[model samples]
Target: MVASLLILAVSGGMLWAVGLNYDGLTGGQAQKVHPASYLCVLLVLWQMLRRGNPVANLVSAAEHRPASCLLAAASIAMAAQIILRGASGTAGAIDTFLQAALVMILLLESDARSLRRLETLVHAVMAANAVLGIVEFATGQRFFPFRLDGATFETDTRSAALQGHPLGNATLTACYVLALIAGGGSLKPLTRLVMIAVQLVALVTFGGRSAIVVTLVLGGAFGLAQLLRAIARGRIPLLAAAGAACALPLVATTVAGLAYGGFFDALLGRFASDGGSANARVAMFDLFSRLPLRDLILGPDPSLVDSLRRITGLEWGIENPIIRVVLYQGALMALLLTTAVTLFLVEVGRRCRAGIAMPMIAFVVLINTFESLGGKTTLLAKFVIVLVALYRPFPETRIARAS
Candidate 1:
């Protein structure tokens, strides 16, 4: 279980380092052989072969009857859709199937019962990425130390860290940071504050506007909850309250000082700019609206990009995961996907009965709007794992009984 946890953490955290894109390979081809998926498969296979008791593992997974059934149904539905529609391309189809397989294996093999172990795994991943980001910031080079020409760190303005893209690094870090905040009282105040500060700095340095927005919103929500809890507990004396109010400006000034010049302005400017990228996404939605109801329900023919290009005379892929799902996989599947995620969030809320999950869920939804997360199986797996860890048996029992 420890080995599995480490595999998930290291692979999911250092995605760019694991998944190398070689020269002469198309994007789809590179995705098909992503090192994270390959390593996961090997790990699963090694466990099965070494134990020689795949049946026992399957039975153990069945203990979580509802989750097991839901996973099985979702996997079948996804596989059937891909097999019937034949995916957008051969490489895409292969990648989808492989990723689907990996997710299934991870869900079945992972033992998330130990919340402490899981938390440690998560912190390890975050710490590794934070160190990598520091290294990349100090030296304008990739941290993986690979010799692949043209495959080195390419982004000049933003910190990619080990997650490949600036947005990917920022989004993933934001999620983990939110999770850490959600695991309230489990960490010391100073330690938690320092961890959040480190991740926030990395997020700001990455300069992903969407990620930045989501992180700030979620972090604010976490802070508000903490304040409310302190008030309810009678921990906030009048003197302390007045002191905090007086120090707010100093805190804000310190944050501003830490941010690079024009950091906040650039974030706002990205939102204000009516660049081709923004126009393309808006045009894609416009094209979606013009399509027939049948296409919306059954998905577009030829491909979303092709259909949009034909209609708007501009080539661009759907950036929103929800929109991409509805466009390519039909509204029904999209509905199912949304329902599953909603149910998971509802369950987390029911178990933990806290405000933490709410902010994290909102962050996930907001980030997915800007970038398609369908292909990011490792990230998704880590997310579900963290959610489960957050509301696992021990914490759930303690919190629920208190409530």
Candidate 2:
């Protein structure tokens, strides 16, 4: 499990690095390295080959956890949309579903201790992403090595860092920080502090208000849940510490945002002017209400895309998730897709209630509302949900102190 995750993270990081300066390259060169997304898929197929029997192979290939299965269904629905529409996006996003399946298999195969190790692997990957984000923001350069550019970080907005999109980068950074919250890993103080600081930088640099909001809300929710759990267990000191760490990001971001020029004011400005981003999102929601039921249920035709272009008077795409899926997949697929995600959360919540893994299902569920789990964000969100549901984190390990 550790090996596979490491491979996936490294491969993703590499691909992301190349993408940062992608503007300079010819289109043909860009296509050359694009196939790297399938590296994790290859690893999963190899594991399937090792399993021997036919039934075992089929079951082995399926998502071992309920949450993963739902996420897998989501991946399929998305891929089907792409196939049906001939839309050009990242193929690796689809491959990420395959990666999720591999992680699920590994979860079913591992014991509790191994599960924690898997968590460690995920945590490491996220930490790496945070570090990469910091580098990108500071130097305006890509982190991963590309076909021609060597290992130097250089600034270029045309090619955001290796992650391709600012939102995707923020998602990777946020997901890891959330994992760090759940596990309460080493350098707890420092990790929490860095996560808070970096999250602010990420949100500001990318202008990804949704990702920032989701991170703040989820971080607060997880922290509160842990605090309550600790208090009930008579671990008051730990609870206090946990509360501080969890609340720090939201607190810091709110203060910083206020100092820089209040976010609330910006939101109001958006609504008032209808030219600010907040109002744009409101407009998208308004447009959704006006879309026909038939289009909403069966997915929008290319005509709707043209209509969006006309109405928005912008010759581009929509950034909102709910509307995007509703427009692309129609109502029926949207309903089933939503049902699958809801069921996964129910299962994860059930596990948390059973005192199995850390209580993070609620946090993930909240985060999913603002960011489409099916889109370009980190695949680890899917892995984290399923791993928590399937294997459960190990019972806390007690290391003996020197006598």
Q: For candidate 1, lDDT tens digit of each residue in 112-225?
A: 454567766666666767777766665656554322333543424455555555565666777767776776426676687788778877776666777667777877876798
Error of 2 at 253 (Å): 15
lDDT of each: 0.57, 0.51
TM-scores of all predicted structures: 0.73, 0.63
Query: What lDDT does model 1 reach?
Result: 0.57
Looking at model 2, residue 269 earns an lDDT score of 44
RMSD, one per candidate, in order: 5.3, 7.9
lDDT of 1 at 282: 74
Clashing pairs in 2: 16-162, 17-144, 140-154, 140-155, 141-154, 296-331, 297-331, 299-330
Q: Which candidate is the best by lDDT?
A: 1
Clashing pairs in 1: none
The reply for model 1, stretches above 4 Å from the true place, is: 1-65, 89-114, 134-156, 228-234, 237-250, 259-268, 289-295, 310-316, 344-355, 389-392, 395-403
